[model samples]
Target: MTIAKGDKIPAGKLRTLTADGPKDITTDEIFAGKTVVLFGLPGAFTPTCSAKHLPGFIEKFDALKAKGVDTIACVSVNDAFVMGAWGKSQDAGDKVLMLADGNADFAKSLGLDADFSAYGMGTRSKRFSLVAKDGVVTEVNVEAQGAFEVSTADHVLGQL
Candidate 1:
């Protein structure tokens, strides 16, 4: 089932590119003792994601932090390299954490995996966003296929 509000996020390893190289980041490390805004997309550099979803978060980074969010992270099924490159191209800088769920482990754990084989993209994540406080979810907004309403940064900011 899809992870719901008040659910404890499942354990999984995600990757993020750093100055030294790719590094493993655990779910606990991300959510424990923090108020985090984590948004997931189908893939990196895809049209909707690049044009709207990710940019919304970037543009609202300060507003999110102002609302007491400790971190704002963007997750995708792509590898760390692509995530890193996309972040650079988007000028994400330190405002957003680019997390790579390369194996879809995190997505599956949350029951948010979507098959895109018909589009030749294979397995990917559904568009979604959540607010987690100290490892337990407080709010969740999952988008329907081809929709972008609830997962936008403005929506999450309004919730906050």
Candidate 2:
């Protein structure tokens, strides 16, 4: 089932590129004892994600942190290398954690996986965002099919 408010984040391993190389990070490692804002997009470097979704979070980093969010993460169905490069290109720096769910395991586990075969993208993540404290969700913002309003940073900020 799709994860919702009050749901604990599922257990999973995601990849991130560190200064040394790709590292494995578990969901628990990320959300444990912290307030996390996790957002997912269809893919990296795609139109909406590149232009708005990701940038919106970067722009609102301080604001989100001010509201007690410990981490703002952008996860996609891409690999570690791509995620790293995309973050660098977007000047994400330390503002957002770029996570790669490579096979969509995390997305599928959340029931937020989307089929984009028509676009030749195969299985990917639907646009969504959620807030969790120590792993239990407090709010979930999932965008409607082909829509982008609900999951934007500004909207999520308002919810906070």
**Local accuracy of candidate 2 as per-residue lDDT tens digits, 1-160:** 9998999999999999999999999999999999999999999999999999999999999999999999999999999999999999999999999999999999999999999999999999999999999999998989987899999999889989
| CA lDDT, candidate 1, residue 150 | 99
Pairs that collide, model 2: none
Judged by whole-model lDDT over C-alpha atoms, candidate 1 comes out at: 0.96
The residue pairs found clashing in candidate 1 are none
lDDT of 2 at 31: 100
Q: Candidate 2: lDDT of 55? A: 98
How high is the CA lDDT of each candidate model?
Answer: 0.96, 0.96
Least well predicted 10-residue stretch by lDDT in candidate 1: 4-13
